[model samples]
Target: MKKEIAAVVFFLKRLIKKAEKLEAEKVDLFVERLTVALQEKFRGHWYTDNPSKGQAFRCIRVNRFHKEDAELLRACVESGVQYTDLGLPKELTLWVDPGQVCCRYGERNLAFTVASFSSDDSDDKEDVTKKVTSAVERVTSDYHSGSSSDEDNGCREPRYITGFSHRPPYQQSLLCHRMAGHVPVFCGDRGDSRRHVVLAQ
Candidate 1:
C-alpha cells in the first residue's frame, strides 16, 4: 500500500508540472496574438474576408421619425407600399414600390415640379428618381469608378474582371463608406446562422 501511494504521488507531481507548463505556454500565445491584433487595429490593416476576421456589412441609422411618420410618407408617395422591419434603430423600415422609377447610381439628377403632382396621384416619380440617384452616386463614389451613364439602358458595370481582380481594397473602401453614412444594401449577417459570423460581428 505504501509503494502504491508513493507511485501515485509521483505521477500526480509530474502531471501538475506538465499542466503548469502548458498553462504558461497558452498565456504566452495569447499575449502574442493580442499584440498582433492591437497593431493591426491601429494601422487600419486588420480587415479580411476570412471567417475569423470579425466584420459586418450592415449599417443601421436611427431617424427621429417613427413608423407612423414613415407610413404617412408612404401614403403620400404611393399606395400599396410595402414596409418591413430592418432590425435597426428605433424607427425605420425598408420601403418598396412596384411602379416607382428605379434610378441607377451615377445617373443624372432629375428635377420635378410639384405642379405636375396631384393629391389623387400616388406616383412619386420625383422621390423615386432622387432616392435611386443618391444610392447610385454613393456607391460609385465609394468605388472610385467613372461616372455612370443616363442612357435608357445605362447600368454601372463592375470595374474588376473576375478571377483576376483584387477585391479586398474595393470592398474595404465600400465598407468604410457604408459605415460613414452611405445608404447601401445590408449584406452582413448579424452574427448568427453561419461559421463566418465573425465577419459580421
Candidate 2:
C-alpha cells in the first residue's frame, strides 16, 4: 500500500509538470500567431517591407504593458485610433470625427475643414446668393424652429455674412455685375472667387 501511494504521488507531479510545459508552449505559439497576424493586417504603405528597418506604422501608439491581454492590446493599438481595456476582457471602442480619421498617433491637435456641395451648379451670383441665404435660413431655423410663438419670449434669428478685400481687379469684376448692386463674394486668396447677392433683411 505504501509503494502504491508513492507511485501515485510521483505520477501526479510528472503530469502537472508536463501540463505546465505544454501550456507555456501554447502561450508562446499564440503570441507568435498574433504578431504575424498584426503585421499583416496593420502594415501601412509608410513602411517598406524590410524587417531590418524596424519600422512601426505611424497610426499606432503603445501606452504600457499588460500581462493579461497583451496580444489583444497590441493588436488593438496597432489597428485602432485609441483603445482602453481598464481591466476588462476586451478593448473599448473610441469615437473619432472625419478630420481626426487620417491623423497620426500623436497628431490629435490638428484641425481641418470639410465642405459639402449641393449639386453640379457653378459658383455664380445666383448660386452664391442661394447658398448664403440657405445657410442663414438653416441657422435661424435650427435655433428658433421649435420655440413657442409668444411675444414676450425674446428669440432672435441668426445671420450669416462674409467680408472681402485686397483681391485682384479682374477677380473683383467677376464678383459684382455692373448692372447689379453690391454683391457679397466668397473670395479665396489662392483660388477663384464666388459671387452672391446678399439679401436685405
Candidate 3:
C-alpha cells in the first residue's frame, strides 16, 4: 500500500512538470509569432513590458495607423496565430494615445490602448471570435478592392483619410476615388479643405 502511494505521487509530479513545459513552449511560440507580425506588417517594435507581471509580454506601437484596426488585424492574422493566443480580450476595446497602439494581457483582463471605444463587460469567447472574423473579412475585402498589383508592389503613397463615415454618399464616393489614386477635380468647395484630412497609410 505504501509503495503504491509513493509511485502514484511520483507519476503525478512528472505529469505536472510535463504540462508546465508545454505551456512555456506555447508562450514562447506566441511571442515569436507576434514579434514577426509587428516587424513585417506594421514595421513596428515588440519588446517585453515587464518580467514580474504574469503573462505581461509586449505591446505593439507603430508610427502610422496607430489608431486604426485594419493594419493591426492584418498583422495579427499574418502572424499565423489565433487572436486569443495573442492575448486579445474577449471584449476587445481599443483606447487611443498619441501615435501608438498598445495592449497587454493580465491574469484578470486584457488591456488595449488604441482608440476611444471601450467595453467593461467581457463577451463570450464565441461572440468575440465571430466579431474578429467578420472584421478581418471586411479588411481583406477592402485591401483587394482598393489597391491594384502595381500599387501594392510599388512604394505606397501616403493616404489622406477623412472622417467619411459620417459624411454623405457623394462625399464618401469622392474620398474613395481619392483613396484609389484618382485626383478628381472639384470645381466648388463646400467649406471642406485639405486641413481636415489626416495623412495616414
Instruction: Tell me, by TM-score, which candidate is best.
Output: 3
Per-residue lDDT of candidate 3, residues 11-54 (tens digit): 22222233343354444454444344434542222222422232
For candidate 2, write residues 1-201 as lDDT tens digits.
112112222222222233343344433443344445444543442222332232223222222222233444553445441223212211111111211111111111222211222234342545434433443333234223433222224534322323334556575556533312223333234343533334222
Q: How many residue pairs clash in each candidate?
A: 2, 0, 5
Would you give me the overall lDDT of model 3?
A: 0.35
Q: What are the RMSD figures for all models against the true structure? A: 30.0, 26.5, 17.0
The residue pairs that clash in candidate 2, if any, are none
Order of the predicted models by lDDT, top scorer first: 3, 2, 1
lDDT of each: 0.29, 0.30, 0.35
**Segments of candidate 2 deviating more than 4 angstroms:** 1-22, 49-71, 74-201
Q: Which residue ranges in model 1 land beyond 4 Å of their true spot?
A: 1-121, 145-196, 199-201
Q: Taking the tens digit of each residue's C-alpha lDDT, what string does model 1 give over 141-195?
A: 4324322232233434322212212345467445434432223433333355321
Q: By TM-score, rank the candidates, best first.
A: 3, 2, 1
Off by over 4 Å in 3: 1-118, 139-180, 187-201
lDDT of 1: 0.29
